[model samples]
Structure formats: structure tokens, C-alpha cells
Target: MIEAPAARAWPKSEAESLPGKLIIVEGIDGSGKSTQLDLLHKWLVSQGYLVVFTEWNSSPIVRSTTKRGKNRRLLTPMSFSLIHAADFASRVHTQILPALKAGAVVLADRYVYTAFARDAARGVSRSWLRDLYSFAVTPDIAFHFDVPLDEAIRRITLSRAEIKYYEAGMDMMLSEDIMESFQIFQGRILDEYHRLTDEFGLVPIDATQTLVKQQQQMREIVQPHLADIERVEGGDLAEVLRHSGLRGRYLQQPVWAEASE
Candidate 1:
């Protein structure tokens, strides 16, 4: 049995004084977290909130390098963790923090917790991963979608044609069969996620429930955060920044002024 790492200190304290909310979702693949986040994003936008959405491993600066490594099957556990760290850092600087400072709600499909869980499962040191992502601010809300292992496997098998090499944790040599490897790998990740739920106070969602029910619960949990937040007029993010009164590099440009001219 793979030994679970002891819980470590959170990299950063809970974010306070930021006018906007950062909401993130985390779960194993097929746990339905992505679908739920998408639903929440749509609902928030419909309510006229200025929302910025980001996902894992999506930073353009490292996208090609990660892809090349993956294609070549060259990423070791450590290299994979570092590449993802760079990606998250780029997004935090270029995408997340600016939006938060602008008072725009930022919806992340995954967050630092992803690294804590996935990297730990990959045999990387939990302490090192925490330090690597120390620049991250605590989310206002982080929802972990929980599902049974068998159900998660069933969902993935039904949804995908085939699982990829890295996705199956094949590099770890857990099993000869791809499907078995995926099951074992995802199980480890799920275990780490459960550990994180307690350590980080992550709100748990029953992914086995109907989507509508789950989303209803999520919105209820989110409503209090929205009480003071104004919906963006015509869904313009710049409008949120202009009215936010927070000084930052985002406000130095006259893009809004140019548009009004």
C-alpha cells in the first residue's frame, strides 16, 4: 500500500480584504467537478457577475513544453510537478490575481489543491509541493466533488475512448493493464483529495447526486459571498475594475476610456 503523506501547513492564509471571490473546484477525473464548475460559471454570468475562468495546465508559456514532454513520454514525476507549477504561476499572475483585484469573480476549474493531491500521489514530497505553490492565495470557496471509486471508473470508461498514458499513472508501473493502472492511480489521487478536504476545509459535494441538486447546493453556499458584489453592467470586466477602486496594473491602461470614445 502507498503510504499517505502527513498533512502539511497551507502555503498561504485565507485571503481577506480582496473585494472579489475566488471559487475553485477539485476532483478526480470523472468526478463531475468540471461539469459542476461550468454550470456555476453560467449561472454566475447569467446573474451578471464579472467572471474569469481558468483551468489546470493551460498556461500558454508552458503549454507547448508540457505537450512535447507528454508526447515524448519524457516527464518524470518531479518534472511534471514543476511544469504544472510554472503553469499555475503564470495563470495566477496573468489571470487570477488581476481579476480578483478588479473585483471580478474568478472561477478556477482546479487550483493548488490539484498539485497537492496529484503530485503527492505521484510520490512527490507534499512539503515541497506546498512550498512551490506558496504564491497562491486561499480561495473563498473550494468545492471537492466526491464520488465512489467504482463509480468514478465507470464514468471515465463510459466517457472516453481510451485513457492516456500519464492519465493512467502508467509511469508508476502500478499495473500492466492500462485500465487497472488508471483505477489504482485515480484511487491514490482520491485518497489525497480526501485528506485535503480535512486539511484545507474544502466543501464536499456529492457527485453521485443529480447535477441540478448539486448545483443548487453550491449556489446556496455561494449566495452569501455575492450579497455585496454587484453584477457587471453588460458583463464587462473592465466595468468591475473601474468601479472596484483598487489600484493595480490592470487599471493603468485606458482601454475602457478608449472604448467609450
Candidate 2:
């Protein structure tokens, strides 16, 4: 494998080395995504890597737009998809690409695959959805946390008392039919993810394990990749976790408020 000198942040060159990789964890909203991210981030850091964790809809700008779209009563599937695409664009420019160039091992909770799967589920033209995310830079690893749709729906219900307006309005989206669609949706994106793996040779970590097992499996999966992880010589998962700043209990601060716009 030929590893070149690391790339610089776009439109500028400080000659900083950026050999670290991007790892993305993706699933439905209620999946234990943040927990796994926290575990992985801390573990990578414990291995002595410089790491950072961010998410789509992270910045205030994206969150504001997401909230507005979420509250609308009659959101067409396509309209909702546009919100996600815009959110992805903001995050790519402001977060993902910058950190990749800086050489930090950046972990993302959700990404363009979300746009692909969710929009395709919503009956959007898959070609157009692909085009919307065609600008996304590839990740070194993208892990899809697979789960039963019924279980996912149950988790979402336990967390939120009411569905978002669009979720509530679509009878098809609310039915087992939709759950079955997740099977098809998952297959399509997994195909895409597999193509990504064949092309970039990504790491895949199964997410069906219990919480403890998930953490352990993630560590095992990432160890070999640590070789490509500059400045991070070893992949002691615990050490990597410490580097990411999310080792202990996480408090979800109320980071979003109504936009005055």
C-alpha cells in the first residue's frame, strides 16, 4: 500500500500531515449510534490517535433547518430529503472535509447513506438521490448498524411520544410494509457500502451485538486499520476511546432552539 504525504485543508496548504482515516457509523435514528461512537472514539484515542466525533445535523445551521422541516405537517418525502441533503452539504464543508485534511481520525454518526436509504424508502428517484450526494468525499470506513425495523420502531417510540409530522402522516411509512421496505432499502445501501469497501476497502463492524460486545467488536475491527492511522501506533481500543473525549457518561445538552428566521 502506497501512503503518500498527507493532504492539506482545501484551498490552503500548511503542509500538515493528514493520514488519519474517517470512520462513519450509520443506522436508523433510534439505533445505539451515539453509544457506539462514544465507545469507538474513546478506544481510538486510548490507542494514542488524535480523534474527533461529529454528526450530520450537528452544526446550528443544519439543526435549525432540520427542526423546521421536522415540524411541518405535510412534508413530502422529497422535501424532507432535500433538508437532509442540505444538512449533509453543510457538514461536509464545515466538519468532515476539514478534519480529514487536518489528519484527525474523524468519526461520523450519520452521513450520505442516510440520504440514500431514507429517500429511497420514501419513493424518491434513486438516481436523483445519488446525484445529491455525489459530491460527498468517501470515508475510509462506513459501518451500517443493522437491526430489525420493528425493533427500531419500538426504540423510536420509547424515546419520543409522537412521530414527526411526516412520519405520522404517511400510512405506508407507518406500516409493516415500510418495515419490509427497510429490507429492500438496507440491501441497496449495503450494496453501495460493499462497493465502497471493494473500492476503498472499508472496515465493516457488525452492530447486532449487545452494548459490551459492540464495543469489543469495534475495537477488534479497527486494530489493523490503526496501521494507516498516523500518530496512532497501536489500536488498544480503550486508548483510542480516551483520545476521542467521550469515554464516560454523556450528557445531551439542549443544543437546538427555534430559529428566529
lDDT of 2 by residue, 84-115 (tens): 78777877666666556656677888767666
**Model 2 ranges off by over 4 Å:** 1-18, 167-206, 232-261
Error of model 1, residue 47, in angstroms: 0.8
CA-lDDT, candidates in order: 0.82, 0.59
- TM-score on alpha carbons, each prediction: 0.87, 0.67
User: Which residue window of length 10 is worst by lDDT in model 2?
Assistant: 252-261
What number of backbone clashes does candidate 1 have, counting pairs of residues 3 or more apart or in separate chains? 0
TM-score of candidate 2 against the unseen true structure: 0.67
Q: Which ranges of candidate 1 are over 4 A from the true structure? A: 1-14, 235-261
Which 10-residue span in candidate 1 carries the lowest summed lDDT? Answer: 252-261
